[model samples]
Target: MSAKRPVRRATPLRKPVAGTPAWVMPVAVVAGIAVLIAAFWVIHWYTTPLPPKPLSQDTTTVVVSMMTGLPASEFDAVGQGTANNLIKPVSGTKLLGSTGKPEVFYLGAEYCPFCAAERWPLIIALSRFGTFTGLQTTTSSSTDVYPNTMTFTFRKAQYTSQYIDFRAVETTDRDQNPLQTPSTSEQKLVSQYNIAGSIPFVDFANQYVFTGATYSPDTITGMSWQAVAGTLQQPDSTQAKAIIGSANLITAAVCKITGDQPATVCASATIQNLEKTLK
Candidate 1:
């Protein structure tokens, strides 16, 4: 018989002591990695400010202002008075007006010759529908012709009484710097409405559009803002008449959109009436 080797007892392997220090290292590392991933996700969400979430209501305060145009405080009284006087009551059948979408106007710097001229009429027309809350009376933009261009704080701007909505968007601050990039929707609207990126381009619901006019006749001549402001004070003066005539043209267009309810002159006469006058 072959000699049998002594049998050795099998040692039972102890399960890794529950929660031992060695195991703790791997668990801590996994926990740390998970925390880092969560932090990265949170950082990404906040860093990129998302587009303005759509409000449930169709109405927007800033949107409507864009249609009428920017408000020029200096021309507040006469400009608005003229627009109010000219507005005609809309016919019952044609009462619907304004897309109710946000309106936006892109203007840059106080040095803009076009804005200098356009501001007067725009201010007047917009005031008819809403109260100008924070219009700056001094010129603020460096590139704008109105070095002391009157400023208006639109945050307080509102039109609680009027049926029409309005919006004004200054792409750049008074310093001629970008504020917010134009929205894709805004870009498309501007592209369709802006006449060659003309300063002071105006559009009312894609229905009425005016490039410039409503201030000094010398606007095309590139006169200073002070000079134009002087002309508007005397409505009957030659300078005022030239400016008013242009304003009347704008009135006609605005009236057409407001259903003539707000522009009497435009409603009373045929296109022939003002077309001849403008020339």
Candidate 2:
């Protein structure tokens, strides 16, 4: 009976698939790893907090320094005419508002490099007489000239001052998309004074109008917000010279409109000297 068992046939080994190679398995594994890595990066990019976009701690410190007045010696070195080339005097216009306070109207787009450059001194000058709430850190248009220039946006900001009323209209966002549209009065002012239709237009109680930036945008092109702000405390730095100089001129103009209400600011010898140079 033991010898009666039939010999079992050896099962034939299966052949490899006709066209598939052994390397296919490793290639598939590598592709899967790459996909996973890309997904992680995409998630991180969306989740991370970026610098100078939403008012970081460092940005806040810099803003505070700007709001605080600089040393008298610093203003002296920069001189009064630093912004003379960009500022123009306008006369024979009605008061901006019925609030019985002098009004400073700023019309600009977030995408404008000129606006970006001008905002620095404007913030500094205005801060001397008032406090700003809800200021946001932003940059100029990435596609426009002097792209990504660090600056602040007044889009959500409110300025409170005993001497003046600050009105800001950010016409477009950083992407050149529509943001805040100008009102009828604002449009009329622009049409009548901003003959070139350029941005960064500022009307200082109809006494002075700044058609463009006080300094060239190139001054702060390659610098970070911190770097530019740090230089503000340095009187000799080119950044300080331009920024502070422009601030002094703007301060002088504002004082003229305010009749030097706050003696602490308008009475400063530096500001008094700067006032003499105003047209």
Q: Top lDDT: which candidate number?
A: 2
Per-residue accuracy of model 1 over 158-201 as CA lDDT, tens digit each: 44324355655555554555654555765666676564776555
List, residue by residue over 74-163, the lDDT tens digit for candidate 2.
Answer: 666666534545667888564455467989999999989999998998898888889887787788876678878888899998889989
Query: How many residue pairs clash in all the candidates, one count each?
Result: 48, 0
Model 2 misplacement above 4 A: 1-53, 57-62, 66-69, 81-84
TM accuracy, model 2 = 0.76
User: Which one is best on TM-score?
Assistant: 2
Give Cα-based local distance difference scores for all models. 0.46, 0.81
Model 2: how far residue 87 lies from native, Å: 2.1
lDDT accuracy of residue 214 in candidate 2: 86
Q: What TM-score does each of the candidates earn?
A: 0.49, 0.76
